[model samples]
Target: MTRSNTARRTVAALLTAGVSAVLMTAAPAHADSNDSCHPSGAMPRVGVFGNEFAPAPSDPLVRAQGWVDAGLTCSPMGSFGGYRTDAGGYAAMAWRLTESMEPSELLSTGSVTPLAGRDDLAPGDGLLNPAGFGHAVVFDHWADDAHTSYLGYEFTAAGVQHRTIPYPYFAGQGDFRPVRAAR
Candidate 1:
């Protein structure tokens, strides 16, 4: 081959290799798993919902906040009335709004705290300090009758995703408290 043709082939080969490398790195870590339950196309997705179980906020950060980037600050969403944080790093903050509510107001909101171990959580119940990561997730459902598996919308490094985690993982971590919010 001529000198010019040889150089062109070499350039093409480099371009192909570069594209392959990018594709490999971009692939999902878990091949068999998915992130959310949105495929249902139903109102109040199985796990996390925004503003009265209507639907999750369009903004990913608002839907689920994580440790590093986006939605790092926690705030009460609505009547369920609790606190959240996407605050990055090892920073931990707890805002106890439940203590100030009158008995009547508390009844109206049906807000309960630290109830994870005490009762069978229903879908939509909020999980505080899940996985001991100081992360928050909305209870989706139990993966099994024994309650060994848990599914929820977790605010993760991959953004808000529908995740299924083993109970032992969180149990080992300790301090999994459940809070229920009235619709």
Candidate 2:
């Protein structure tokens, strides 16, 4: 083949490979089972009308801050992106925003990764209480230098809360586990 023709073919092949790679990595991870009653069209479309859920970035602080900046509140209308109340609602927000996966799906699919311990927790990591009732908190920062206490945002009947939480209280019985977004 002519040099020009060969070069053209090489460029086309590289471009094709690049596009394929982008599509593969850009697509959100999916699970065969999703029990959570996620709102229709909620996965991709965020912050419409009443919904305040948005995907968190890789940075731990950025993830938590997204909720604060969006003024997210725990509400029953979580699927619709309305105010989301309680830890489950917060889970819905975090799971949806971070992995584009539902919270229940994370549990069932074994996609959630366990952190070594509370000390391994990061600002944007999650403190998931999957015991009696599922709850999730977006870790913001350590309240003390020791990391024994932390400040985070959670949804509640009263509305969104940013409070200092003692590690022992939340991590009791190992129910509140530190987790990272399923990659």
> Taking the tens digit of each residue's C-alpha lDDT, what string does model 1 give over 1-183?
999999999999999999998964673442112222112222211222234432234332233333223323222221222222221111111112223222123323444445537256766555554321234455667888888877765533343345676652344334445655442
Q: Which regions of candidate 2 are displaced past 4 Å?
A: 1-60, 69-72, 78-86, 95-105, 168-174
- Predictions: Cα RMSD each: 12.7, 16.4
TM-score of candidate 2 to 2 decimals: 0.54
Expressed as tens digits, the lDDT of each residue in 120-166 for candidate 2 is 87766777655433456677778998878788765544445567777
lDDT of 2 at 121: 78
lDDT of 2 at 57: 49
lDDT of each: 0.40, 0.54
lDDT of 2: 0.54
Candidate 1, position 113, lDDT: 49
